[model samples]
Target: MSTFAKAGFKSANYNSFRPHYPPSFYKILTEYIGKEAGKTGDKVGKTIDLGCGTGVATYPLLQFSQNVVGLDLSPPMIETANSLKAAKLKELGIQDESRIEFGVCAVEDFDAPPNSYDLITAAECIHWFKDYPKFFEAAAKHLKPNGVLAYWFYVDPVVVNFEGPHNEKLLAIETMRRAQQIYLLYVYEDPKGLGVHWDRPGRDILRNLLREVDAQIPQDLFKDVKTQKYVPSVDGLLQLTPQDLRLVREKITLKDFTNYISTYSLFHNYSESTGAGAEFLEKMIQEFETELGWDREKTLLDLNWTSGYTFMRKSGE
Candidate 1:
């Protein structure tokens, strides 16, 4: 997360390339919160989104809550998010631009009155948070009884299928295998790759789909806990989660896919260290094209990330 705070980091590129959560997932979340709200005869009121980089996931919360606050440690990210406030409100046809706000603050340091918020969410950012017990304790303290706590993430996407000259599903499986190999070679396995540049425990926690964080959720502090994962497969078989919870599934050009790779914090660190960032990414794109027999510009890849989410409510006293 410190990498995102550097002066040289490109918040705009991070905004442009990163995958936003699907409305469908929000539907699932809001429905859960809605059911809880019914118990108290209260409408969804306020939300605070932690580590809300560039306001991607933060903006969408406006649809469910009357007020939303997005917080991040990176000044640049908060600046970028604040700059887009009016525009996002306009896009949402929201009359009160003040309904949304962005601030520069670490998630752990963010303080609010007890029982102040109806919902608290962390999107693709909670893994970077230290001290899960303290964090969850803070969340439970700040949330109204029965208020919701949710966090979700999307990990490396795999080429599940493609539209190309070779249309066979078997070819798709092979392409996925080769793509995984390329990812490992460039992102992890190679000495010259970005492996050494990654921030630890955070990266490891994310790559494992937040299983560690989920385990430490402190069942006593929260109730009605639910967690789900959508795993991508190289073998030819149907793999699906609930349709509404399918957070990241898209068809994008290989070039666009590589652009997404450029937004990685580890890639930025590697580029700074080696000064061959662009060249290295191009090589990765080329290797994918050459090994998979797909053109970077023309092939449309059906990409599915290994994504998961956990939703729970603050336990009653």
Candidate 2:
């Protein structure tokens, strides 16, 4: 398993930059569980969110489950998730302080009683697991009858088009695409003789999470499998000109953008190994800015992204 143990990686920055799963995504999850429960009236009793980074997916889960546990292998991530749990509970006016809990441990090492969880979710980090088949087998053992095992992951963002002068719009779109490519090259290619290969086997499993799961899960262990894509409406502020639709844009300074990139585990590893990872990141940023003609003091990128989910219930009436 790839170590996400880099000391310089910041969970806060990860929380800030990672695109969140849409509300509809969670709604679909709850509705599916409700439908599966049917007349038995079994609401979700408990949930465990694997790799719940900073509680991004865990907090929203509280609406459907009575108790939630956020687990991760990284202590920093678990610490941030616990902190967020406290802040979010207060913000939502939820007084049941025990509703959410967090722990630092690998999925393989974590244990629960048989038939303990009503739901289990892994958000974006399942690929990192060294033994997913074993993980699924363990999950099957822990899930209650008609319980769910759901997971979702988003692909690299795509720059469809930008709103600007007709001519400049095309150029802007291409520039954005090029900039993303450059960033990815630095992360995945390690072109600078850094002896770092940032890409991992886990990354290869992302595009086919369900496929991988299907291959690993015992046929009789799960059923009613479903998959769906979620494309949220882009933010209006990102449009250079008034239009019916545009891509989502979080107004981030160049520094913030670079910090976001630094949150990538591979980047952290590369930096630690070479001691020049920060320098390389600066070089990437400079090239990206030059490509976009960006003024560091007053430029923001409209990041475009979409996500998908796969859900299935434990086999039982």
Candidate 3:
């Protein structure tokens, strides 16, 4: 992992080119908001995108409201996000410029006025927050009555519908899991912060955070859809280059694949782990290569995923 001073793929090309959250994902949020607006007879007010990495979630916020503010701890990430536009915007020749304002400040320190916002959306970055209670408190205070606080994410390389081989799916899922783990901790610079803990490590932390958030969850608003499949195996995940989208491809395990598991920073983080971790990853990669038997170029790799979401809204009060 890069030092605390270094940023991860959060500011890298992957973020620039990777898939944005599915339209349906935003559709779901908008539907929820519309329902709220209908009952309250008022549209959702201004929104804030906390940790809006490249504003991937910001574009979707347009579906519910036009006024949105995106906050992030990394200036570079925010810069990248602020300049990025929804892919569909270009495709449809429709440009909604200035719907989001990108700022470099941790939400913990961002002192916006209370009850100022109608919706707050924190995508993949919420888990990295150090103080969930403070964040929610501030978010709740900023949100007006019936305001919605939403954090969600999506994966790329949409790999669920493939039927190539079991190993392909296994490797893709494991690779995605490990890479996404970067946010839990060690994702940011060492001193800067770590992830909430991707699965286990992060899960324990999320479990505790959820306990506090449970009370604030709007009965119809809180939705933790953990099943968003947004992370794909990087073309270079195992040091394997990305493959062109070809339906019905071949496969292979680690033995037949690259010897450079060094390409994986997840393993690099464990260099001090008595060499056991390295050996284990090597074995796992090799086993995957062997089982797949589809090593066409032995250099090209495909990533798959089973995507879902975790969401929460304030219960109707």
How many collisions per candidate?
0, 0, 54
Instruction: Summarize candidate 1's per-residue lDDT along 51-78 as a digit string, tens digits.
Output: 9999999998888787899999999899
Relative to the true structure, candidate 1 has a C-alpha RMSD (angstroms) of 2.8
Better of 1 and 3 by TM-score: 1
Misplaced by over 4 Å in model 1 are: 35-43, 165-170
* Sliding window of 10 residues with minimal summed lDDT for model 2: 238-247
Q: Write the per-residue lDDT of candidate 2 for residues 114-192, one digit (tens) a residue.
A: 9999999998887777786688788888999889999877755544434322224435546665656765676555567
Q: What is the lDDT of residue 135 in candidate 3?
A: 70
Per-residue lDDT tens digits of candidate 3, residues 1-317?
12111343235443634445655556566665664322323446588887776666675566557567877777667767656655634643446556557788877788777668878877655545666566766766777766777665332222222233334455655543443343222333344222221233333434344333344444333343222223334343422112111212123232322223332233334443344544654545444445444332343443343233445444335
Tell how far residue 51 is off in model 1, in angstroms: 0.5
Q: How does candidate 2 score on lDDT?
A: 0.69
- Give the Cα lDDT of each candidate: 0.84, 0.69, 0.49
Q: What TM-score would every model get versus the actual structure?
A: 0.93, 0.83, 0.58
Pairs of residues at least 3 apart in sequence or in different chains that clash in candidate 1: none
- Which parts of model 2 are misplaced by more than 4 Å? 35-43, 161-170, 193-195, 207-210, 229-254
